[model samples]
Structure formats: C-alpha cells, structure tokens
Target: MKYQYEFFLPQNPKPIDTITGDIYDCEKKADEIVAELGINEDDDLIIAVTEVGNND
Candidate 1:
C-alpha cells in the first residue's frame, strides 16, 4: 500500500516576530507610541523586554 504523509500544514495567518527591548509597562507604552507617532504599515517600532534563561 502506498500513501502520502505531510507533517507540516500551512497556516491561514502567518506569524511575524517583532523586536523588543527591556522596559516596563510594555503594552501601555506600545499603544501610547503607536498613537503618538501615528505609526502605520510603513513604520516599525521595536519593543523592549528582559530575557530569562531556562537555567535561572
């Protein structure tokens, strides 16, 4: 018997990664800046945050 196997499936909405940095109140700041600068598709802003290691 012959059969086809596909492990990976295509996602309807592709995921994207946004660069972020260390900061407090990230959500509030992201929103504030988005509005203040009138950001659009033509612009990109990097968010900041702290990173924790698995050993920690």
Candidate 2:
C-alpha cells in the first residue's frame, strides 16, 4: 500500500484551492513544501494524505 501527500490552499468560506496536483512520496517532503511555500501558521493551508495505487 503506497501513500501520497497533497497540499491545498483554503478558500475563504468555500472549497480548498489546489496548490499542487503533484503527489509527494513522504510526509517530510510534504512538510518541506509548506516551508518552501512560506506558509504561515495563520495561513489557510490544508495538508492531506491519500492512498495511492489502490483500487479498493
């Protein structure tokens, strides 16, 4: 079972905006992205993890 991480920008009073459709292999890589993007603690950013290559 493989997994991937994704990041999104939160839309005010609505859906989250996709920052990158690219999937990260590890959580560290995803965290790096947040740092690289200079996302602040007060910033509306969302981090998610999903299963990859899984049909079931």
Q: Which numbered prediction scores highest in TM-score against the true structure?
A: 2
Q: Among all windows of ten consecutive residues in candidate 1, which has the lowest summed lDDT?
A: 1-10
Off by over 4 Å in 2: 12-25, 41-43, 53-56
Report the lDDT of model 1 for residue 55.
Answer: 28
- The CA lDDT of each predicted structure is 0.38, 0.53
Task: Indicate the residue-level lDDT of 44 in model 2.
Answer: 47
Q: Kindly provide the TM-score of model 2 when superposed on the true structure, using C-alpha atoms.
A: 0.42
Candidate 2 at residue 20, lDDT?
A: 27
Regions more than 4 Å wrong, model 1: 1-24, 41-43, 51-56
Residue 37's lDDT within candidate 1 is: 61
Expressed as tens digits, the lDDT of each residue in 1-56 for candidate 2 is: 55555556676443232332234344455466567877763464666666556534
> Cα deviation in Å at residue 25, candidate 2?
4.4
